[model samples]
Target: MLRVTLEQWRMFKAVVEYGGFNQAAKKVHKSQSSIHTAVHKIEQGLGVKLFTVQGRKTQLTEAGEMMLRRANFLLEEAAKVEAVGQTLGEGIESQLRIAVDEIFPQHLLYKVLEQTSNQYPLLRIELMESVLTGGSELLQNTDVDIAISPVVLSDGFSEELCHIEFVAVASPDHALHRYERDLTLEDLKSHRQIVVRDSAIARKKDDGWLGAHQRWTVSHMTTSIDMITKGLGFAWLPIPAIQVLLDTGRLKPLPLLQQSQRKAQLHLIFKDGDRLGPAARAFIGELRYQCMQLEEVM
Candidate 1:
């Protein structure tokens, strides 16, 4: 059997990584002779020269370079194992599941996740994108640790995260834009309206104007916005999601006599606010910071 110990592999890596056995021993708090002996054992066991003297400096052979790369990957995995243990010792959870409303800014979520990964590399993340009351329902059932939605739960813990602007919009060429005066609910009744279904299984809600005789209901905000932007129907959509499209003239606001836009208060909720883990708390802070950044860009 070709038996190779971790100590031997580590010595190989240490010599190449720290540029010399003497330096590697100093960094790892071991004597230079011990590191040299370990490396010598590895070379003899494999019957190959791992390092070659090039002038005054020691250089790795091709086989040594390949082994060094593989060693790095193993060391990284070992570091992750250690990180998980350390975090758990500090009362941090192994995984954080967060439920987010479909209307929330997707870019902001990406930014928050990017930052969180840097801060907690070993923590696992599970993100659920829900529509309307979907996120709130998950919170009620204890399916997620954090819930970010417009619906405020009556119990547990909740705090206002941010305000999302829902603007009534349609394709630029839609019939609603042909009107000479401010449109009314009666005017909207003549056309088709795009409606997004509430994601809650039991507590579904009938939100916004449903006066239109012809309407199409979709399960996601993307589908609803796609239908409206394609001139299939008109509906209110969150500006953070469609601001670029709106700016590019793909959609226009309905000339409503009133209520052209509505501000929805989004809140962050935790099942046990007082007992939240370190990772969950850090994620909430990242969420708030990223949302504020998105607001400035929007």
Candidate 2:
């Protein structure tokens, strides 16, 4: 007879993830004895030991490690099945997992989510924010349902959103102001520049600030902007994020002497020839709508 119960599978995963039956029981709101029994049943059904009892802790055996890997997938699949069932009864009950670069403000994206929630009340949304390259990698690996990145998609991927402007900016109190009237390519070369080391953007092999003799690299766009605002460095910021600074006479935009200065291209990437899930397709539709609306306003 089939012996691996859902409770046992859940308890097994909790033990593997939480490190012990006691902790897993506390997390899952079950007694330690119940947790132990569930795991024992799982191990017995599989005919393999799941955990090796250390003095005061439990560690996964090779068999346990393998099971732990599959356990996560199984659990996720089970949740999706339940979600699908719920969807059939009411509406789309699945989730959309998206990876986004830090360049886009969460507050702005929240509006999109709000619209989505109203349209699909049963849909859940999760967002993972990272740099452009990291988000792209997550999309490539199918770890996320969608990725908003700043790299043009090609080869194995296809584009969903496009056309973003990137501009070079500096604080008014910074040294770049010295060349306010005489800002030549040569003058720009002698200064230190703050640059974003976006993993995906870097792969484009761009020489964005070729004029700068000294360059400092940062991973976060906000951090780079904060440093620039403090007169610590100059950086390239998206036109929208730096618009306020420019309007308030806090930051100055540099003329792109060469095409290299115009390096950033914001894009939405996904697997080529792939059909997006209902939630994912809905998210993409919202994104496209936002892009079109923003384009008109901009």
Candidate 3:
């Protein structure tokens, strides 16, 4: 028999999370005395102090910190189980939100969505496009149910969907391409570089070379490609994104001495795959099928 109960743990967690017993009581719809009783029971059962007073504020003791960590984990698992049960009873979700990396091939994304929409005419789909850490940010903030990105999120379930190759290229008339021999980092550094700004609201990241003497930071990869195509600057563009331009001689690959192209492995991620709703699962299936269609061409 255990002296500690899940309810006691929840109350204790609520108290710490909400900042005080009074706030916790209001959030949990319990009396302040009940919150106090729960905390007191936990402390007594463990034979240790879980809190200490620091001036007018309540602070967690060392023991409290340890217990709180475990409490949070338990609460998270409980929430997952409850959510799964609810979704199971509900059949299919009315709406599903997904975030994808802006670097992902647009046509493929649309193809998957088109098929998925046809399958579930009643399901509403909300799609968000982000760059670098942007997709992960939306996921961490719980703003979306699923994220497809190259940046692997810390705790999300992930499956590698495909790899995208970014090729360093410049307009044929650009000064960087005028070089007779293979381009060196030092030689390329003298020319202008078009960079795409990471779309993450928080923790924005800089991708590729950031050492150009003249750098033009743009909001999207399309802008970067536009700049490079017009001979305004040079940039590394996803092959699929600029394949037409490359074939039309609007953009030419930089004759770099080494590593002119970089590969980014994109992944499909979600908070909890096992607990995902039917609509989300259906979307994922179509997404994978579309990815396979592209892989065949590659």
Candidate 4:
């Protein structure tokens, strides 16, 4: 059995990631000699040359590539273990950056943040309200740890959470609901309409899915809601987002497209396949759990 120190494996993984010991040492806050020595010890223990050094630059051997794969797995598992302990312990100061679309309300999210802050007193929460499309791109670039977006998931990312449904709504005085029967796309087109500020909405119209022209556009759902409250136009909104307004009779369900209203999806997106940190993973868990609870009621 080969026994490799965690530090040695870390040095090796750093070298693989950075492509050189000198750069790896700088990143790990260690001297280049120290990193070289660690890798040397690992190679000695395994009885294989891990790297092919032509000069100051080095390339990974077959053994190096194999070890790199295992080393990264071990490092990730160890990080999870460490993070689990840190999560239980109090007073570990950390910062978490999260991006969310405006579909979710600040008051509700603030409650979640308050609970997290109370439990993890030292954790600082930084929130940014990014539109769905822009937020997805930010998540792909790893600019934000996690993002709540409405895009369908694809390869190279994880859809950690999604449970909300989109519903068609309008103000009580809107013409769509006055007929007391389901409204057709033809009826919707007869009136000027407010639409979500997304290029995708227009594309849907052009494709005949919406079958109407939009009279106005707004950046956020709240803007749409506000506009509808003042009788601007009807639009689709997340059920949970507009539930309060609906309950208060500020908004009325058109139910015109009830038969065709497909549930829209909201996804919690992450970068690099599965390299999520503890804070990011925990937040994803909470968001999923809460959304699941909401789904039960719907």
Candidate 5:
């Protein structure tokens, strides 16, 4: 038997959160007296003082502070329970909108999508290839159900998927490689550098070193790689994306004293993990499995 009800705890939290009975009443669409009565009932039922009144101010007592923490967990768990019920009531989602960063390997992405589609043939998918903050922005705007990005959303849930290695590379005959010694940052600045533009419209940003005096900013990674292969410029590219070129001797890694290679961690971010439908869950499972397989081989 519980001394207090869930509604009483909710009212108690509302009072603490909104700072006063009157404010909480307005926020919760209840009368001020009802809000006061609810908190009073909670304090009486628990046999503890939950708030103290100073000159024109209501503050929580030490006991209230601890109760607030427990109350938060209680409410969150209750919400999750309701979300699970709602998910069960609805069938598998008909469509899934996913935003994937361009930096991720295309082969792995295609493999996961293929597997997911095979399982749910009726499911429609909208795949957006984003860059840098673009994926996070789509998530924040509720434009996508999931985002695979190096930039994690502060307000959303995320799990690390994999690490991508980027190596600085250029054509074998490029001016930087002609030095015949470990190139310094100063030596590379004189030549053209290929950079991919950030796709985010609102808050665009640069990801790596932009110290080169001359730069050619393109919209796609393929364009940057193509430019590098033609000896138009040098750029740092993901190893997975350029592995074939490296193996074929068409692209050669730059001999830099430091920072010749860097790693970026990609994460799978969800709009609401608890409320995901069966199709979305299946897609996430397949994505994780594929990433695991890649890790084992590396």
Candidate 6:
């Protein structure tokens, strides 16, 4: 048997959050006396003083601080339980929103989407192709149910999806390839470097090396690849995306002394695993399965 009721804990939290019984009562639309009584009952049940009044200001006691932390977790779990019940009763979600970084392999992404569509034909999916921190920003803002990004959010859960290899490359006719010897950082600094812009509106930043004397920033990776292939600039391109270009001699690897290749790990991020609907879970499962297949073949 529980000594303190969930309602009592909620009222206690309300008083603490709103700063006083009167304020909590106004916020919760309850009588001040009732709010005070609920909090009192909590303290009595726990055998601890939860708050202290000093000059009309209510401050949490040492025990109150500890209790508040536990109370918060308890309430959050309770809310999640109720939410799960509602979701179960409501059946599958009508729409799913996902933010995927452009760096993820297109074939695998398409395959995953195709499999998910086959499972939920009537489900609507809003896929947002993001770059760099763009997917993370969307997940943080709760604009997307899931995100595939190189960046991991501090408040969200993430699992390593796959590693993407980026190789420094340029067109065969580009001036950089004219160097007979292994290139140094100084040798590449004089040339124009093409880069994709970070898609995040707030807290935007650049990733990887940006040491070139002249820089050309584009919004999409395809644009950067196009510019590079046209000898407009040189940039590090993902191996999977430019594998055909590399094989056909359209793009040649830069002969750097070291650090010519870089690897970035992409992660699948979500706020809560338990909160995901069947559709979202199916998408994630398909993605993992496809990645495993790729690994086995490689």
What would the per-residue lDDT of candidate 6 be over residues 133-152, giving only the tens digit for each residue? 99999999999999999998
Give the winner by TM-score. 1
Quote the positional error of residue 285 for candidate 3 in Å. Answer: 0.9
Model 2 lDDT per residue over 1-298, tens place: 6568666788898887787888898998999999888888887778998888879889999998898788788888888777668786754436778888777645567877888878776676888876757777777767787788865445555564645567777787778776546466676677778876655533433435555778887777777888888888776677777778889988887654554245455677787535565666677788878877776775
Instruction: Please give the TM-score that candidate 4 achieves against the real structure.
Output: 0.59
Clashing pairs in 2: 133-200, 189-211
User: Among these predicted structures, which one has the highest lDDT?
Assistant: 6
Q: Rank candidates, lDDT, best first.
A: 6, 5, 3, 1, 2, 4
Question: Which residue runs does candidate 2 get wrong by more than 4 Å?
Answer: 1-85, 88-93, 104-108, 152-157, 200-207, 255-263, 272-275
RMSD score of candidate 2 (Å): 11.1
RMSD in Å for all candidates: 3.0, 11.1, 15.2, 15.9, 17.0, 16.1
Two-way TM-score contest, 2 vs 5, winner: 5
Off by over 4 Å in 3: 1-90
Error of 3 at 233 (Å): 0.4
Alpha-carbon lDDT, every model? 0.86, 0.73, 0.87, 0.71, 0.91, 0.91
For lDDT, candidate 2 versus 4, the one ahead is 2
Off by over 4 Å in 1: 22-29, 46-48, 54-57, 107-118, 286-298
lDDT of 1 by residue, 1-298 (tens): 7456777788888888788877899988899999988888888887878899877687899988887887788877877888878888988888989999988888888888888888887889999988778898998998888999888788888888788888899999998999968998889988999998988998998888788999899998889888888999899888988989999999998889888899888888877777778778888889888777766765
- lDDT of model 6 at position 28: 95
Which stretch of 10 consecutive residues in model 6 shows the poorest summed lDDT?
A: 81-90
Which of the two candidates, 2 or 6, achieves a greater lDDT against the reference?
A: 6
lDDT for 66 in candidate 6 is: 96
Q: What does candidate 3 score on TM?
A: 0.68
lDDT of 3 by residue, 1-298 (tens): 9888889999999889899988999999999999999999999998989999787688999999999998899888888777656655778776889998878999998888888778766667898888898898899899999999888788869899998998999999998877788988888888898998888987989878877899999887878888888899888889999989999998999999887999998989888888787778888998898888877888
Q: List the residue pairs that clash in candidate 6.
A: none
Q: What RMSD does model 4 have?
A: 15.9
TM-score of each: 0.86, 0.62, 0.68, 0.59, 0.69, 0.69
